[model samples]
Target: MENRAVLAAVLMAALLILYQVFFIPATAPPPPARAPEGVSKPVPPQEKTAPPPPAVLPAAKVLPRLPERTVSVDTPLYHAIVGSEGGRLLGWTLHYRGEKVLAERGQMGLSGLILERSGVGGQPVEFSITGGPVVLDGKAGEGTLVMTGEDAYGVRVRETATFRADQYAVDLSVRLENGRRVRQTLTVALPWIAPVKPGTDGAQWPSELVWQVDGTVHREPFDKATVAEETPGDWAGLDSLYYLTALIPKRPPTSPGLSLAVGKVGEDRVEVGLRGAVTLAAGEVWEARAQLYAGPKEYRQLRAHGLEGAINFGGFPLPRKYGGLPMEWLGVPVLLVMNFFYRFIGNYGVAIILLTVVTKVLFYPLTVKSMTSMKKMQTIQPQANALRAKHKSDPQRAQRETLELYRREGVNPLGGCLPMVIQVPIFYALYIALSVSVELQNAGFICFGRAPGWFPFVGGTDLWICDLAAPDPLYVLPILMGVTMFVQQKMQPTMGDPNQAKMMLIMPFVFTFMFLKLPSGLVLYWTVSNALQILQQRLMNRKPARVAGRGAKDVARV
Candidate 1:
């Protein structure tokens, strides 16, 4: 039986290796070829054509230009014409009330503002803003605005001239018939920080500016001398054009830096802010508009907005298909539960623990049955050993006797294995969930520190350490997991020869080492599960030594 287990494990491992090395790559489609320039085919000649003389006509009288009318309103509720050019959000104009934005042929930078594009073709993107008497500065005003399209690369502008002021932030509030009102406040509080050139003195400053997004009020001094390489993309693999740095001050200031980060909350949607600590004025609702990107990371957003790649955190080499699907599928449920737990427990670590407990409880029955079957196998080890020894030379006969013994004892040899096999999919699903879970990105877990740096391949500023998007280090966890696994195996009844038991010990180490570099959350799951299993085994059975002695005595009598 031990030999059989070793063979099964070896077969499974071979299959996995083959699947990863050959099958998966084979299934991926080849990349498209690039088109060559200046390649044109000759056109066919027309069959026939008629030549005609040209005639000149007198110029018609010029028509007078029509006067453009404008509308004004007292209420804040109004539609805005929004648009983007070359993937950059330009601006928006209040359709009925505000002044029109000049159709400029230059790039417009709405720095520090989150913007997302909508509408098709040259069609205007429209959104309603309610809740204002139109406050521009210290006064109230109103005007008509029209935002037009431009025909140039990287040139976008939304014309609105209600009362432009350099000092005051623009506030637009909108009310819906459903009684939900939204207020969008636009503030140009800070200058657009330029991207620190690589190998320059300023580059180090951006890298040294440590920002925390765990709803904590901590600050680190801005180091103009620190430099760090910029990651290429956002969380969704979109291009990152800017490198964001926290404006931490040495001394406590009256005001602190403000920014938002986006992460996936669930299956269908990404949560924009998980731990943003922004305050809203009384009667002033806060709203954020950002381009929700779902693609590969590049420097596009940073180049366009100068806001840096606030979304990208590195880890894991999850094949996009396998990685993205599981994350997207289980993101919502996991986040929802996590959020609920955090709200009540006030600790993200506790939330994860609770989440794990809940999950295990949900799968308790299967695990219980698996344990029971393992116990039965242990109980019948003596008979199994006897059968194996009786037909040692005849391997097929040995297997047949073993099967008959299992049937007679009402034991399923594969029963214990089946539940574990069933759990693979579930474990994989959770693995995907935790890997892409934005909630867990900067989240903390005791002294282990932030999720990123807590374990290998999880956290840290280094690309290798931060590569949450790749496979793990495969050294620590896998070995520990294998050790625990071997111990669990040792606690189980043995039916095979010395070779089989030796293989069992080796198998645990192999699996444990395989998991070392995986996400800490996945490791946490396995570790916790293993501990529980050990406890469960101890509680379920009496002295294994005594059982083994009884089995040996029975074998001797036979």
Candidate 2:
């Protein structure tokens, strides 16, 4: 945000949607927050700043061009091709996910380091490859690919990428030696540079620039206007919905720099990197090491590396510290439970079902108590209304009698709502866990096939529920979920306004349409939850309610 006023406005807007009584209102969904905060140079509202300019471009080189070579490093975890030109990562394919991370043609492919003078417009140091085609044997367990080069500035550069057979992470270390007689300070940037047009926006597979500073992580929209923090932090990188590529510093740099940014590198090109400077006296070598994580956002896997923050579990949209609600605390536990269930069940779809069942059971006592209180209130409402009518001439007495009736009936007005209130955090966390857990990707539950040309826009093969992470192609789970929710709502005792009851009934359809495109795993969870609620309500109705006779007895007295 440009200033406190803007920040406050954003916070208020976020609060309008978050923490609402009903997640999906009878009204339309609230609009989105304008943007997430970026920790970078704060600019004046009237003054516009370009994304930090690309690292300085070197002056036209009169020297001959050094040949660029691509070296292949095949590990058990990943197959990668590295370009020698700038030590850029050319191609990376995760063995487990079987997804090839695409890289734009011109920009550094996310593993290259660029050296420039200590500010914008600083001349970038160019490297000429003077090394071999890096070699590594995955069967040997571990190895390193070293690409050595030297810049025109009296500096020698060594970029070594360490690979292990069993890990998704690759550690990169850059060793720089000042070959000059005098001391020199140069800005160092490791960029995940890509070609993105200005004002580009997307959500299906969003790419955000993330960085941590002073122990807090901030994710910024890849705005056309660059956002880069000058103060260096633990790490910076770019990530998409299911995949992550982050740079975590193994240790703080010995030499500090003038600026650090996760921003743009050039026109039509974007970058997210930790920028710093190293001042080295002649003949002195400075080295910096960072761990690069490039893999699926498996909660347990990333957590093991302390990089689990890369997963975007939707949080409370807010003007709060760290820019939003930190749902990870609760969400992580839910995710862990779901994964644990997966280990036992071997199918993520069933795992999600088990998770939902466990959650319902865990909160069963709270749910029963809430329902009981609502039933009690429903039972006594008519008598309370009669008392109010009797004392209508004296409004104070009417309220007073209503309170006494409530007390005698042993009904706590807030009981029905308070337990639900206590459960809200867990509910929100479960939603987030279902949404962001990557294990559900392509994890199947069931599949139904359609004959060729059976319906318009319908294909031949079995598509329904084939991928739990994707929407149900036939809209089965969402409709079932909605139906279950409506039935559950209808079965519950309504104690308040009739119009509110009707609105509550209408919520099912609204959510049905909303869930049409949501991941099937989430829809499955909702459906199961609603079904459980319905079953509980039916069982409660079957057994004579403890307060069922109270209403009739009180009405007779009246």
Which numbered prediction scores highest in TM-score against the true structure?
Answer: 2
Instruction: Note each model's CA RMSD in angstroms.
Output: 26.0, 18.6
Worst 10 residues of 2 by lDDT: 34-43
Provide TM-scores for the models: 0.43, 0.80
* Residue 220 CA displacement from its true place in model 1, Å: 37
Tens digit of per-residue lDDT, candidate 2, span 1-558: 379989999899888758564584533223333212111112233234344334333333244565766777777667777776667777776666445454433533575777776443433334444333434454557777776767766678887778877777888777887677555667677766655542233212335777777667777766543744466676676767777777776652443432346776556656766566665555666666677777788987787778777777766755335466788889989988988988888988888888888988999999888988888888888898888788899999999889898788788999899999989888888887888877887778886645376665776644678778789888889999998998888898873688898889899999999999999999999898888889888877776656677677787787
Candidate whose lDDT is highest: 2
* lDDT for predicted candidate 1 compared with the true structure: 0.40
- Clashing residue pair totals per candidate (backbone < 3 A): 65, 3
What does the lDDT come to for candidate 2? 0.71
Model 2 TM-score is: 0.80
